[model samples]
Target: MLEYLTSLNDHNLPYPDTIHPIVVHFVIAMVLFGFIWDVLGYFTGKTQLFEVGWWNMFVATIAMFVAIIFGQFEAGLAQPYSVAKSVLNLHTLVGWSLSGIITAITAWRYVIRSRNPQKLPIYYLGAGLILTLIVGVQVYLGDKLVWVYGLHTVPVVEALKDGLLR
Candidate 1:
């Protein structure tokens, strides 16, 4: 068990590729699309769009936890260097925070949906906007981890193995 656990691919992941990014992308898309749907529903007065938004947020809230689980596992395998550490830490923090925020927002949406279902309050829209902004910041931090720091990439892994990154 320990031996198998210690063995990892060139990308430093036990799996073939990074699952975190794959799952996180879905969460990101759903959250953004859900917010868009809500905005459209609010403007167009199409209650059906609210249903779309509600389902999206519901799934996104669940998927966020899955993404966070994979993220934590992958981060454990990342072996980030000095500069990448802070960014990785920030990303981890934000990811965890998002899970809670998304869950709370979804719950709030559920109450609104249950009570009226036909109308969305202005504050909910504002909350969606705020969530979108936070998601944007998280995306930037994640991008920095991958693009700038090159965490878990082939070259970075090779460099680490060669004792080139300290």
Candidate 2:
């Protein structure tokens, strides 16, 4: 994914900025942390989390929308990168699916039961932790799709064309 994203450039002109990739990485990391929190709840016993109601789920789900915006924005600036087209499509599909599942699970307790998260029966935190790892894998896959494949001609290219690679 990094290879593909690194290959972004309309008219073969490399992007000359860095904000997009850094921000995208930051956001993805944050989202993963949220899932980690959920996973923590499943393991080591029913750990306590602030019953912030829908706010917790809301932010995580909304992050997906933000990621899509950044993704499309970067893609727009770096056209003709065929790898992005395919990865972007897959990314969007997986993101929406994950968000939907998260919402559904949260809603079951928040909306249907009309109860606070604290009142709901505890679930296995291992499931959530496993999911957190899975999310990381997805993000890594996106990176590989862009980088490993995009950098065939320029192996040292930074994934962030217009922004800081770090």
What's the TM-score of every candidate structure?
Answer: 0.96, 0.55
Instruction: Write the residue-wise lDDT of candidate 2 on 34-69 in tens digits.
Output: 555554553434535424323555565666566666
TM-score of 1: 0.96
Clashes of each: 0, 25
What's the true lDDT of residue 113 in model 2? 35
- Which regions of candidate 1 deviate over 4 angstroms? 1-6
Best lDDT among the predictions, by candidate number: 1
lDDT of 1 by residue, 28-59 (tens): 99999999999999999999999999999999
The C-alpha lDDT values of all candidates are: 0.95, 0.52
Residue pairs clashing, model 1: none
Root-mean-square deviation of candidate 2: 8.2
Clashes in predicted model 1: 0
